[model samples]
Target: MIKNFKWLLLVSLSFVACNNDDNTTVVEEPVSSGTASFTKYVALGDSFAAGYSDGALFKKGQEGSYVNIVAQQFATAGGGDFKIPFTSDNFGGLLLGGNVIAGVRLYFNGAGPAPVSGTPTTEVSTKITGPFNNLGIPGAKSYHLVAPGYGNVAGVASGKANPYFARFATSSGTTVLADALVQAPTFFSLWIGGNDVLGYATSGGVGVNQTGNLDPATYGGNDITDPNVFASVYSSLVTNLTANGAKGVVANLPYVNTLPYFTTVPYNPVPLTAEVAAQLNAGYAAYNGGLQYAAANGLITAAEATKRTVKFVAGSNAVVVVDSYLTNLAAYGIPSYRQATAEDLPVLTSRTFIGTLVNGNPAAVNGVSVPLADQWILTKDEIAEVKVATDAYNVTIKAIADAKGLAFVDTKVIMTQLSSGGIVSNSFTLTSAYVTGGAFSLDGIHPSPRGYALIANAFTAAINAKYSSTLKPVDLSQYSILYPAIIQ
Candidate 1:
C-alpha cells in the first residue's frame, strides 16, 4: 500500500511540472520599423550628440552618446552598421602635429573633477576615412555645419576649422551637410545650436551678443550667433536633409544659464569671523565714504550709492565683483565695484579661485579684497541677453520642425525640469545638482552617461511618436552617472 501511494505522488508532481512549463512560456513584442526607415542613419550635431562627458570626448563617451543609443535601438528594426570616428585612446583631448591642442578628460578625484594624468593620442592631422554615420563635431555652431573648409586640418590652428571634424572629414572643403548628403541617409538626427550661445554663457558673458550681425565670419568664438542666421542655416540644413525624402529628428537649445557650469558656484560663499569682517569693512571704508560723497555731491543718487556700497557682515558675506553695467565714476577715481547678489551667477571655475589669497598676501584675497573680474560672474543683465537669444533660437527651431514635419525634442523643457525638481526615469530620479545629481558629468557643462541615456530615451520617444515606429527605450540602470579616475 505504501509503494502504491508513492507512485501516485510522483505522478502528480510530474503533472504539476508540465503545467508550470506550459504557463511560463514567454513572448516578446515584435519590434516594427513602422512608417520610418533606418537603412542609412546619420547624426549631425555638437558635443552633446558626440557623447562628450566629463569635459572631453573619449571612447566610452562616444559609445554612450544619444545618437549611438538611438541607432542601437534602430538595429532591432532595420538599422545597419552605425560607424563612429573613434579616438585613439580613452584619454580624450586631441593632438595636432604631436602637440596637445585640447586637454585630457576630467574624472572624479574623490573630491571634485580633475584631469587625468596623460597625453592624448588622437591626432587631428591623421585623417580617418569616412562616409561615416556619426558626424557630430564638438564646438560646432549652427553656421559651422554649412561652412566650407570647416574640417581643413590647416585651418585648425587658425580657429577656422573644428579639430574633431578634421579627424574624419572626407575632404578639406566638404561641408558637414554635404558629407551627410553623400551618404544618402534614410533617417537622420540634428541637435545643433547649443554652442551658439554656450560659449558666451560659459565665459561668464564676456563674449558679445551678435544678435544683428549677419556675418558669421566676423563673429568671435565666444559670441552668440544671431537668431536670423541660425534660422537661415537651420532651414537650409533641413531642406537638404529632407530633399531626398529622408525623415529626421531635431532638438531645440536649452537655456545655457541653467547648466551647472553657471549654477554650481554660489554668489555668497565667503564665511568670516567678526574680527576678519571688521578688518575687511575697514579696508573698504574709503570706498564707502567715496560713494556717500558722490551721492551728496549729486554725482549719484542715494539709492545708487547704497546699491554700490561694499560691506561685509560677521558671518557669511557676498563676494565683491566688478560690474561694468554700474555707473562709471572712473573719472572721479571710484571703480564699478559692488558686492554680488542672489541675482548674480558665478561660473564654476570661480569656486576654486574665490577664497584664495592673491600673491600669498593674507590681506589680499581674490574674491574679498581683490574683486572678481567680470569674466568670473554673469550679472543679471547678461543672463537676460542669453535668455533672449535662446528663446529666439528655440522659436525658430520649433517653427522649422513643424513646417518640415520632422520629429522635435524640446530640450529646453527637459533642462528646466532638471533644474527645478528633477525627472523620474524608471526607478532613478535624475537632477541637475552637480556630482551627486547623477545627471550632469564632472565637467558641469556636459551630461553624464546616464544623462545621455535619458536624452536618448527622449529622442527615441519623439521618433516613435512621429514615425509610428516601435523602437524600445534603453534601460537607464545600464549606464553610469560618472566615469571613474582609472578606467579598466
Candidate 2:
C-alpha cells in the first residue's frame, strides 16, 4: 500500500510538470536599430515626400506619407519622433491671408473625381513652429531646396517662396536645407527632382526643356530643370545632410509619363456613329485637300502629308491635335494640325474638355472639330524630351547616392513595374490603373495609402540590405486605396 501511494504521487508530480511546460510563453527577439542610427530622421523632397494625395496636402494624407510610415517602423528600432506639419483639416488647399489660392482635395463621387465641397481654412500666413522632421514642399524644384527666401511668407505671392514651406519654415529667410541642418538629423531621405520635370509634363509640354540653361531663377515654373543644375543641387543637399555623419536613403526619380495621370485617358476616346463620322470627315475635307495639294506641289513630303491628314471612322476615332513639331504651313494658310496617335499622351484634365461642345454648340466639338491645343496633350517629341531629362536626373541621383554611401531606392524601376502588368505586395497585386489600380490616389499622380505602404517597405528593404537591420515591413492590406469624402 505504501509503494502504490508513492507511485501515484510520482505520476501526479510528472503531470504537473508537463502542464507547467505547456503554459510557458516563448520570448521574441527584439527589433534592432542595426548599424545606422534613426534617432533623428528627416525627409526631404516634393509633394510625394509630403504625402500629398488626391491632389492636395491634407491631415490624413500627411499621416499616410511614406516618410511617416517608415518612421513608424523606425520607432520599434529606436527611431525617435517624426514631426509633420499637419494642415488645419482634411479639406486640402490653402488660404493666403483671406483668399483661397489652391483648390480643395478630390474625391471619387461614384462616377469620377470631383472636389470635396468645403473652404480650406489653413492659412499660409499662419506659420507653424518647427524644426519639423518632414521638409517636403509641394511645387519645389531641385534648386529650390537651397535657395534662400524659399519659405518667406511675404514671397508667396511673388513666387519667390513656396506656400507649403512658408507655413512651416523657422524664419522668413531660412532655406529648407538650413532648417533641416538645425536638427542635426542622424538619418534622412531625399526624393526631390520630380516637380522639376513634372511641371513641364503636366502642362502638356508648354514649358521649355531647359537642358542647357543653368540659371533656375530665369526658368519658368513649368520648365524642365537642367541636368547640371540638378546634379549640383542634389550633391550639395546630400553632402550637407551627411556632413554630420548622418546615414540616409535616397530615391531616383521615376518617369512621370508612367503615372496614371498621363496613361489613364486613351488617345482615341472619341466615339462617333456612321452619320457623325461622315459629318466630321466632311468638316475636315478642306484640310485633307490642303495636305494633298501640299504633297503634290512638293511643299510637304507625301509621307508628311499622309501623317498630317485627318479622317474619322465609324467607331472610336483619334482626336485632332496641334503638333507644333510639324512643318509650318502657315504661309499656305494651313495650321499644324494632325490626328493623335497611340504614342501621344493626353493630360488627365483634358478628359473633361475633350468631348464637350464649345459654347454649347453641338456642331463645334472641341476635340473632334476644334482640335486640342498644345496644353492638352504631350506629343511624342515632348515625351522624348521629358525622358531624356528624367534619365539624366536619375543618373545624377544614383551617382550622388553611391558617393554618399546611402541606401538607394530605384523608384524608376518600381514605377515601370507598376505601369507594365502589376506588382504583388503581401498577396495584393497593384497596377497603375487610374481609380481601380489600388496603387494610385484619385489624383492619378500620387500614391494611394497602400501604395505609400509599399514604398515604405521598399525603403525599409533597402535600409535593411545596406545596414543589416531586421526591420519588418508593414502589412499593405491595412491601408485604404481612397480616402472618403468625409473623415470621421
Candidate 3:
C-alpha cells in the first residue's frame, strides 16, 4: 500500500511540472474596442446635397445642410471637427436670397415675369463657405466631378479657382472633393446626381425653346447621363474614399418631375376675362379675314404686313408664319384643342390670365369648352424613364456600399416622403408646394430649413446604427424658419 501511494504522488508531481512549463506565455488577444473610433468625416454632392434653397446663400439655409448638422453632432460625440466650405455670410451686401449668381430676377432684369408656366427661379448661389466640409457644388452633374476646370467654372477660388473647395483646400487649385479625400478623411457622406435629371425636368424636356412654353421639340431625344460614365466616376470616387480607410455612405437620386414646381402649374391654358376674350377673338377674326382677303386677291408677297412678333430690320422683310407655327396652331385647335395659339396666348405664362370674371361669371369665348394643358405633370413615358434611371442609380449605390461594407443614405425615398407631406416639424408641414409652404422654396426644387433638419437626422441615425455610437440627432424643433414667403 505504501509503495502504491508513493508511485501515485510521483505521477501527480510530474504532470503538474510539465503543464506549468508548456503554458508559460499568457498574452491576451486584441479586442474590437476601437470599433467606434472614426474621427474625421467628409461630404460630397451637388446643391440639394449642399442645402441650397430659396434665392440666396444664407446662414440658415447652409446650416440646414444635413452634412453640417451631422458633423456638429458628431463633434459633440467625439468626432473630430468637420468644417464645411460654405458661402452663407452676412456680407451686408443686401443681395436678394435667390439672385446671388445674377440670375432669376424681375422681368426688367432679363428673366421676364415669373412665367405662369412653372419654371425653377433659383440659379446657383455663391460659395459662402468652402473647401469646406460641405463639398456640394451647384449645377454639377455626375461626370462633372472629374471634369477638368470644374472648380474654375463653378466659382472663383484661390488655387485652381475653386473658392468653395479652396477655403478648406490644403493646396491651391485642387477640387473640393479631391482635396477633401486627400486630407484622409476617416468617414464620408456622399449624395450626388440629383441634378442630372432635375435640369431636364425644369427645362421642360430637351431641345425645347427658352420661350417658357411647352413644346415637344424640347425632348431632343437625348439621355443626358451615360450609364458607363456614371458607373466609372462613382466607382472611382468610392475607391479613392476607401483607399485611406474612409467609410462612406452614398444616397440615391429623386424623381425630378415629382417636385412642386412641376406639379402646381395648371394643366389648362389660362382663362380670359369677358372683355379680353372679346378683344382676342375680334383680333383673331380680323387677322383671319385679312388672310382670306389677301389670298383671294392674289395679293401675296406684297411686302407681307410685318408680323408683330418678328421685327423688320434694315429693310429686310420676310412674311412667313411658315409650317411650324401654322401646323402647331391647326393641330392644337383641331385634334388636341388644348394649347393656345401664339397670337392668342402671351409670350410667357402668367397668372394674370387666370382670367378676370365678367359680371362675376367665368367662361371661355362663346361659352366654348377648352381642354386643360398638361404641363407640370410628366408624361407617362417621361415618368417611366425617370423611374428606370433612378432605379439604376439606387442599385449602383447599394451594390457599392455592400461590396465595400459601407453605408448608404436613401435621400431619394426621404425626399419622396417629404414631397408627399410625410414630414412633421414644429413649425413646418412639408408638402410639395412652392415657397408658400415650408417644404420647398420659390425654386420648387430645393427644401426649406425644416426639410434640411429632417435630412440631418436621417444621416445621424444611420451613423449611430453603423458605428455603434450614440450620436444624438438635432431637434427639428430647433431649426428656424427659412423664407419670409411662408405664413406664420
Off by over 4 Å in 2: 1-26, 208-219
Residue runs of model 1 more than 4 Å from their true location after superposition: 1-22, 208-219
Per-residue alpha-carbon lDDT of model 3 for 198-314, expressed as tens digits?
Answer: 555554333233322112232212244555667777888888888867776677777764466665544344344566545544544544455445545654323332231222122
- Residue-level lDDT of model 2, residues 1-488, one tens digit each, is 99999999999999999988999777777888789999999999889899999999999999999999999999999999999999999999999998988889999999999999899999999989998999988878888899888888988876667899999999999899999999999999999999888988988999853332123354356888889889989999999999989999999988877899999889999999999999988999999999999999999999999999999988999999999999899999989999999999999999899989999998888889999999899999999999999999999999988888899999999988999998998889999999999999998899999999999999999999888888889999999999999976
lDDT (0 to 1) per candidate? 0.90, 0.91, 0.53
Compute the lDDT for candidate 3: 0.53
Ranking, lDDT, top scorer first: 2, 1, 3
TM-scores for every predicted model: 0.93, 0.93, 0.62
Query: Where does candidate 3 stray beyond 4 Å?
Result: 1-38, 88-100, 103-131, 153-173, 207-223, 272-379, 425-429, 484-488
Q: What is the per-residue lDDT of model 1 for residues 401-453, given as tens digits with 9 covering 90 to 100?
A: 99989999989999889998899998999999999889999888899999999
Error of 3 at 406 (Å): 2.0
Q: Worst ten-residue run, lDDT, model 2?
A: 209-218
The root-mean-square deviation over C-alpha atoms between each candidate and the true structure, in angstroms, is 4.5, 4.0, 15.1
